[model samples]
Target chain A: MKGFIDLHLRPNLEERVEIERIIKRAAELGYRAVGVSLPQEKLQERAREIRKICSDLDIDFISRIDLEPRNSLELLRSLRFLRRRVEVIAVKCLSKSVARQAAKDRRVDILSFSPIDLRRRFFDSAEAELASKTQVSLEFDMAPLLYLHGNQRINLLWKMRIETIIARKFDVPIVLSSGVSEAWLLRKPEDYASLGYLFGLDLENAKKAISENPKKIVERNRRKLSPNYVAPGIYVIRRGKDCPK
Target chain B: MPKIVRRRYIAVRIDSDQTIERKDFIRAVWSSILRLFGEYGASQTELKMIDYDPTKGLAVLRCSHKALPMIKASIPCITHIGASPVTIHVERVSGTLKALRRKLSI
Candidate 1:
């Protein structure tokens, strides 16, 4: 089996020091693959340098676009344009309408909340139901949990617990990420797996969130992007007796 | 029947721009545990700071085996000790301190 993957390393291109440190540190911490979230407009340009850095350390670099579409209409437009361009598409669900749209979109891989604002976490039972029918995974980031304190921290945990219960009930996959742009914020995979206990995930499911769930998301994207792909669980055979070519 | 006391040792590497003393590290870890798991979980952990090197930013901690997940969750929540930002990455965990020390060659 492949090693672990952290799907939300938000390394900014302007911060050269942070970009290098974040990628190198992730490699040292034992992540085999990482989905680097870049702004949609900057995706192609920013990927080159980050991909090179990751290759040096033998880390699989996955280009990811984090869409913060203002409305459902804007999300549809971005999904139409960016779906095939990036390996992973994570939507920053800031508003209720956007959250609902992102949750229901098959093109979207992860449904992420704002890191700084706890109020922006709009995930609930309705969103969970929308996400369950699709391939969308609810991302629970540990970065916010690290910095939030006192009552604010309690508030976020309570929200997370409720959302987690909802996700479990609807059978939506949950993906755990460091969700940190800084190198120092990066923790080992096992550490994040253990942190899963706080979110009401069992040990086995916690481990899977870090490894298997993310892996399946990437693999699903690859399969969809494959040239021979016809539809879900349907592919073309080029060399078989049933094949025309 | 006899009851067995299970213990685990964890080797952690601290990442920070400044040096962190053993006491501050302990305070941060303990505070995190209390904040997340409360006083009852704190008592059950049997948490102890066995060895610390301020210069190297390396430390070894001992805890009840059952509390391994508690230690793992608590340490990552410690983003700061006093005014300085810090992060602890667990490098290894073992049943015996000697085995952990051998693994780290310390």
Candidate 2:
């Protein structure tokens, strides 16, 4: 069965419902896995507890770090420090330069950009090409569509449509994330696909953006972080005496 | 006049904490579609609430075949109905209302 994964859900602990209840809600919504973002300091300890709840609910929990990099130096340092600790590393790029840099790095799984941040042409063809080349998926958050109203919503949708067009042109991998700060904000996978369709993706591509693409990212990152994995396409063969050299 | 309007029926399931009135739900859907697609696109859709069950939170909505994507695309934007947060999930889409009801068991 093709499992659906929400790769950018920020669950609010302060919500009326408990964290476990939120996880259960996600599971009930047909999400096989949910990537939860927490502060770097709280992630490790919180992830352990969250994982237990996720396991109980028969859902995979991914530890995600949402970083807002101010400069290249900070970006590199954060990547180095967090890459080994977290399952998913999503960087919210504040500038075109940072977006370009993040797209070129292998450690960065998702380069998340808010529609509000795209006041100018931040992601051009060059950045899209680099992202496609480096296999860094462009993350489009659905929170704005749910929260923003009137012109703000319209403008954000317009900006997202342009980004989607660019992503399609470059054949860049695009993943739709809820970016929900609360459990109630979580949406069904089909809902996310519908939003993706509005943002200029075809039905199949939109569905893939919410399911296959995100699943591939998680699977790829999991392998990359495994002890036997030396590098991309270079895994260790422990007992390969009979294998062709 | 000939029946030139090619229609499609979408089976939608509303997941919410509170019961949403059919009127409020229809209003939300129309507003969202209008907001996203504008007057011209909304005209193209010819959207209508064919049937609704508030208890089950299931509704069958009708729209032009050409504008089905736009309608489905706009459903997610109806995040709330009368201050109650809601999530609209498009369960199925069919050429006929009968088929949609049969498929969705509504």
Candidate 3:
């Protein structure tokens, strides 16, 4: 297995000690890279320090933003402004229009839902079909499973199972996140991959959800974010006449 | 004649806010397994804590080889020990206790 990546940690930057502990724990748990979701301003303010901490711990850092747009208009507006600025953009689909729009948008990297609310999940076959044609991946956060119990956990698993079926039917990609807003919620990558068995995913597909899918998203976005990026599949190596147009 | 059961040992590092007693840790794990897998599933695991160091929060657990994945899955479900939040990481797994201990020296 490749070095795993957990891509949806919401580390609170206000507590420097806490954030460092989380990053170190992530590295200790064998994550090659970790992505932290923050507001735009917080991300801008702390990207450097976060990067430094991760680097010292020998873990790669990614800047991610989660957009909870109420409507398609807001989703589109944020997509345009935030696309080039962050390594990963996950849209929490609150309404039908936002889900549809996010499913088809090229700039959106992940489509996430409220893990606790079945009604908030939006990855139907329709959404999966649209997402399959684009580069977007459906995100499954495991944090809620560790906390919720009884009916809530059952309902979330039921919804997740249905979403998994739809995603698999359309060949849409799926990514697993720890969804750790706090440090203690983190778990080993293998534990999570195994838990994917509770859903419709086989062990191999589940591992890919945490490893290959998220890695590809981050790597592709990194290429786009690079200074030499000219267009998709195009880059500028030399600036002089030697540069090929 | 009785049949011999193949067993595996899991070396885990417990990350918690306070030093944990071995009995409490094992009980918490049992509670978690019961919650997630129910009584029959818990019985199948044959879960046991072989060793624990309260000062270091390191321990070794024994379970049926076939139930390895079940043990791994249930560990994450144990989020707290009496309100002091905790997380456990499986450092390594081995067929023999000696090998597991040698590998863990963490």
Candidate 4:
């Protein structure tokens, strides 16, 4: 069975639902896993607590840290420190340099470029090539659509269409995140897929953004964090002396 | 002689705190389509609310086959109807309303 996972879901603040309640709702919504965004400070303590609750509910909960760095140096420092700690590392692109750097970094799992960001055109073919080469997925957050209306919404959609075209041209992985701050805002995976279609992704590619691409990032990072992992595509295993050579 | 227009029925399930009337629901969908795709695309859809159950929050909507993607694309764009917030989920789509109802057990 194909698993559906929402790669970005923030803790419900306005609704103030308990963490367990959020996990239960996500499960009911047919999500096999959900990535919960947490603050960078005290990440280890919070992740441990959330992981326990998710385990009891039989839902794969990924601890994600979202960073909005002011410069490339800050971004790299945060990435170096947090990569080993969290299951997913997402950097919000605030400048052209940061966007380009994040796209080329192997440690970065997701580069989030919102339509409301400062850059008129945040992503171009160059960044797309870097993203494709480094295996970093460009993220499109759906939260803006929840509030923006009329021409504002239309403009965001137009920008998204251009970004999608560039990403598709370079064959860069495109991932969709709801960026929901409230529990009710959490949408079903199929809805995200439909939204992807509006952004110019075909049905298959859109579905991949919601499922396969994110799953691959999680699995790859999980292996890299394992004790036996030496490097990418290399693992070390102890051989028993008693076994025939 | 005019050829028959191929139609598709989408089974939509509404998730909300309060029950929404069928009239209000159709109005919401039309306004959403208009907002997202503009007047020309809205006319092209030929959208209609075929059947709706307020209690269950399930509805089967009919649209031209070519406009199915446009309709699906617009479902998530509807954030609210009146003052009540709602989320629309497209459960299934089929060639006939009868087939959609049977598959969805509506």
Which model scores highest in DockQ? Answer: 1
In what order do the candidates fall by DockQ, top score first? 1, 4, 2, 3
DockQ for every model comes to 0.75, 0.67, 0.62, 0.70
**Candidate 1 displacement at residue B90 in angstroms:** 1.9
TM-score (chain B) for candidate 1 is 0.95
Instruction: Report, for every candidate in turn, its global Cα lDDT versus the true structure.
Output: 0.88, 0.83, 0.88, 0.84
Candidate 2, B1-91: lDDT as tens digits: 8877788988888988898888899999988888888898899988888889999889999888988889877888787888888888888
Error of 3 at B75 (Å): 0.6
Interface RMSD of 2: 1.3
Q: Can you write out model 1's per-residue Cα lDDT over A48-130, one digit (the tens) per residue? A: 87888888878999888888888899999999998888889998887899999998889999998975687788888889999
lDDT of 2 at A111: 85
Every model's Cα RMSD, please? 2.7, 2.6, 2.6, 2.1
Mark the regions of model 3 whose C-alpha exceeds 4 Å error after superposition: A241-245, B1-4
Model 1: lDDT of residue B75: 87
Model 1, C-alpha of A10: deviation from truth (Å): 1.2
Residue A57, model 2: lDDT of 87
Sort order, lDDT high to low: 1, 3, 4, 2
Candidate number of the best TM-score? 4
